[model samples]
Target: MHLLLVGPPGAGKGTQAKRLAKKYSIPHVATGDIFREAIKNETPLGKKAKEYIDQGKLVPDEVTVGMVEERLSRDDCQKGIILDGFPRSVDQANALSDILQDLELALDAVVNIDVGDEEVINRLSGRRVCSECGASFHVEFNPPQDAGVCDECGGELYQRDDDNPETIKERLVVYSEQTSPLIEYYQERDLLLVIDGETTPEQVFERIEKELDALE
Candidate 1:
């Protein structure tokens, strides 16, 4: 099933995407991961993306579309792919539609894990990470055994600047401005699945599983 998962920063869409990909034997393709790999390897597309990244500018759609086109054509995607982050704007969504239409691949669904503004703020603001091992913990959900410390690596957990309330609020604003239309676009096509995102991560994944099962 070719799928798209859309949600706010703290929506846990990534975790659910991973689980759904594993269950359905599809590649979980995240734009950030793709960019990191491309930029680290310095591919032609990566070079283009890096010019924007180095200048603190967003990578243009042409460059991103090219890289994604290359990725989706791979043999593994014969099954399908779960897209985590891409098509932030309606223009990109149209571009994706063009690509998929040309490839003759149908999108199964577009899922939105919907959590409200205050809940999103609280969830993200309380997030902390282990810098050394990249382990994520929340003050509320899964606190480390030692307060502000990682039990496995003995590393101090620190809140990321991006997780700050002000920054996260700005991100949500940008997301709403850029992605709301895309959400509506898919909704009109009768492909949007809205899931309550305030639930536990396990429950969220279970909900995604049920949605995908119904689609099948």
Candidate 2:
């Protein structure tokens, strides 16, 4: 069940990926997690990535591809992996195809969690996070019992700049420009599963499970 989860920023694809990984006994491989682990352990490629990070520049695709290649080569990934936040463009998707061919592994499905623009804006703009405990909440969907406070840790809840409406719109524009073609690229291959993301997380996961089950 080698899988790729794709969605807009507030689409909750990450949550579904985690659940799918746990349920299927696969590693949940996120690009950010891979970079951090590599950098923290000071691998050769990680060192190269760090140099770019120190300069506040995006890590080169070659470096990123190398790291992903290394990760997929690991024993745990031999079973399969749930990939999140990689292959943002057609070029990267092609690189991923190459990497998989080298490893002799094929992707089973690419799940696209589809949420509308206004829905995404509402979901992200209403999001709040605990300052101390890092707990998450939403004003409309999952509000804290006490206003502006964490229910679990008594921490003050704050909105991240990235969650602002303007920032979210900008991100969606960037994502549209970069990822739309990637979606088409996969769709043409008949490996895409499009699921509505405006529903509850449980419902969304259920839909994803159904799709994966169909693949089996």
Candidate 3:
């Protein structure tokens, strides 16, 4: 079940990763989560990543690669792991190859959740997060019980600045520019699985499971 998920921000990579990892009994490895855990735990790499993350910039590939290298070396990853928010560039992709080589491991597949810019805008624009409970609400699909209020908690809901249109477009640009090469890299290895993301999350997850089952 070892796999990688590559998608733009707000493309629901986290949602899909959660579903797939649970179904397959694989650890979901997200770089952002790892950075936070490392920083909170005061690890050396976490300290280095914090400096970059605080500035709204990416951690350098060397530091990020080292962190992921250490993560993959853990015993829990021996059976399989699901990667999210990683290998954002060709260099990182190559670095991943080296790391997996060192571990004598091979990725089963790389799943790409492809969504259009307009769809992403509509999806993210409607999203609101609870300031207190941290619950997510989508105005269209899953609105809260009260407008501008969290259902689970009586907290005001707010949109993150990064969910704004301009920031989302900029992130899309970065994702395309950086991740396109990794897509080609995996395509060349015959390990790329492209899935349309406009469908419902369950539909998309079914597609992913089917793809992985085929690989098995």
Clashes of 2: 0
TM-score of each: 0.95, 0.93, 0.95
How far residue 8's Cα lies from its native spot in candidate 2, in Å, is 0.9
Model 3, range 39-100, lDDT digits (tens) per residue? 99989999999999899896889999999999999999989999998888999898999999
Candidate 3 similarity to native, TM-score: 0.95
Number of backbone collisions per candidate: 0, 0, 0
In candidate 3, which residue pairs get closer than 3 Å at backbone N, Cα or C atoms, i.e. clash? none
lDDT per prediction? 0.90, 0.95, 0.90
Residue 82 lDDT in candidate 3: 93
- Top candidate on lDDT is 2
Give me the runs in candidate 3 sitting further than 4 Å from their true place. 55-57
